[model samples]
Target chain A: MKARAFSYFRAATIEQALDAHALVGDDARFIAGGQSLVPALSLRLQAPRLLIDITHIGELRGVRREGGFLRIGALTRHCEMLSEPLIAEFAPLLQAAAPFVAHPAIRNRGTFGGSVALADPASEFPAMTLALDAEIEIAGPSGSRRIKADDFFIDLFETALQPGELITAIYVPLFKADQRFAFDEMARRRGDYALVGCGMLATCAGDRINDIRISFFSVGNTPTRVKGAEATLIGSSLNSERIAAAQAALEGDLAPPENDEVPPAMRLHLARVLLGRLLGRLGESA
Target chain B: MSGFDENLLDEADETVRVRFVVNGRKVACEVAPRETLVDCLRNELELTGTHAGCEMGACGACLVQLDGRAVHSCLMYAVQADGARIDTIDGLSESGVIADLQAEFHRRNALQCGFCTPGMLVNANELLSQVAEPSREEIRDALSGNYCRCTGYEAIVDAIDAVAKARNEGGSAT
Candidate 1:
């Protein structure tokens, strides 16, 4: 299916993009990398009147260290996560999740901000953002503001971003020397969206998990953060008994809806299995 | 007599001008904002070597290198590619980077129906360029996005493996 005809505007700056979108009102959609948006347009799932091409906007591209956080430009492509030195040194969780996202070709064009802003329940980056305690920066006509990832994603394909507001960058606290991270997912195929995926970051002191943040995707509306399960593992060394307790705590954290492909019961089972495996790996790595 | 559907009329009248380099040659054309790079390539420039199996990004038949990065042409707008350099199967075939892999594919019968060969070759070319002697698992991972309904992929892996070994051994890619 062909997309509905639309006017195109290549924005040279953030202000230009905001002005274009504001002029077009709600009928305008920002196109960066165009990995997910282009497919939606081709399928006619969305028919915006104006496509604000923001890929050329210099302000929206790069990975750098700012103060205590790694400020990754919204337009940073998925492939850049693999090569960017700052990301490797600071936010290694993103680097770990990069290969599991789609494939090399799709990764070459898909953007970090686009993935997080889209907030697909099954996508890896959004959930990883939660695990990493990243903050999303938004620029609007009035002014710019930063919000925690926890409050940013509200629902399926929904975000706190107001109309005419563009995500400018994602700020992640630089990884500490004692921090340990792990990410894994179970997919029918390598490149297919995961059936159940999990990412975790823990501050380890000796053998005990001092603090940990656990996030799961493909099991709920938003990237489900298992705070209850995380609480179970905090301050305790990862052992078989503690892993079992954390796995049991998932029942309270996630309420994944039933789907045709995988029943809700089976999804819960897979989530438990995944949590166990991830915790096992985290124990070894720590 | 068919009625004049307003939406159809609107789509028919809308077109945008785009210019980009394809296979080292600069080309310009007028296309709709919705026109994908694969459509612009096949219909406008007459470069049909890049096939479009799934208009969605899944099938990978519409794979092309944009500014040296491999991407799905079907999932990109022609205008979005403006001022960019693109490389397609036609360019790669003539560039001699995958001549050895092509010959090995022929020798191993890696292709059956031949619909997925161009995309497979493009993906394999990328893999061999990066890792001169990639293991079988790495080749599978690289080609995972591309779907081949024919030849079970064993022969394809063998073909890519042979090329990787030959290239690593200081032999030219035919």
Candidate 2:
């Protein structure tokens, strides 16, 4: 069904968008591509009084390599993340996970920051951003500031982004050449949201893992990075027994929500087993 | 009366101007705020070639090319169509490969009630453009977004396979 009546504001620049957001307060929302927001509107889940369309803001639409990090525009589409050359080089886990975000139609319109800012507990990018230790670049009336991905997610479907703040770009640190990554998710159908998902980014040299980051979604209040499991597994030579222990640790670490959509216990079990398989696959690929 | 009663926006006396290029023609007019692209194409434009089944995104009978990519039109707002170029089933009728798919659909009886034929043709045309020789699995995956409740999916696969074989063998199914 159609969404309720709301005023639409088309912003030609970032300043204009932020000002409108501030003036409108929480009643206003910044629309990048409207892939997620429109669905929420269609379902009447979100009923904002105004929609500030920032699609024409050229500042929010490029992926570039900076001195020490890869600066990706917030409005970059999901498919662009999948195939971008630099993303393939630096954020291989994001590249591996991109194809699983909705279907091609949604991928063609859904923005990276839109998903990350929405902070859906079951989304793909939040967990990946956390594992990669991404720094979110925000712009608001007070000017610019950076927030760590760890501090960005407040809770389920909640983020620390204030009403007037716009996530301009995401700064991803470099991944050493020896790094290997893998992402795995189980969905009932091709375009269905994940029942349980895992992303593994690990670096190895001479059979010893120097860096290991594991993250899971749909098994917690937010897209949670498995800190406990990583604490135990990182800097160790991951083997069959070690990997199995890590899997059990991850299962105990997650606390997924129970809903009509999924049972919490099933999601926990799936996340544990999938994390194990995904991390094991990364170890092999390395 | 029945349509209005079912419409949640029946009480809102509002309309938005929608302008877009459809099948090489510029159509511009005011539309009910709640109107969908599928309704605009099928009802307003009288391009009934883009069918609306399921009203939700599940069935791809409303599939159309929005800015060169396939999308379920029923899921899109009509106002979003402003300034965008769209290709409905009618536009694809003249597409060289679509005619081939239609002929194959006919030859293999890929359609029964003909409700899902428009979407099937649109999706199949996209696949044929990308992979002129797609395997059965690839063909299935390409049209995975579109749902067809008839022909048991076999005849459609057979039809696509025949077209692929013809293209590979340096023959024209058209």
Candidate 2 docking class:
incorrect
Model 1: per-residue Cα lDDT over A92-126, one tens digit each: 99999999999989999999999998999999999
Candidate 2's clash total is 0
DockQ per candidate: 0.39, 0.20
- Candidate No. with top DockQ: 1
> Which 10-residue window in model 2 chain B sums to the lowest lDDT?
B1-10
lDDT of 2 by residue, A1-286 (tens): 6676765555778888886777768877788767667767777888776667687789998999887888999999997986789998887878888877876656767799888988887788888898888899999889999998889988877888876899999998877778777888998987677898888777788678887777788777888888788877777887888888887887668877767778877887887778778777776775
Clashing pairs in 2: none
Model 1, residue A158: C-alpha shift (Å): 1.1
How far does residue A97 in candidate 2 sit from its true spot (Å)? 0.9
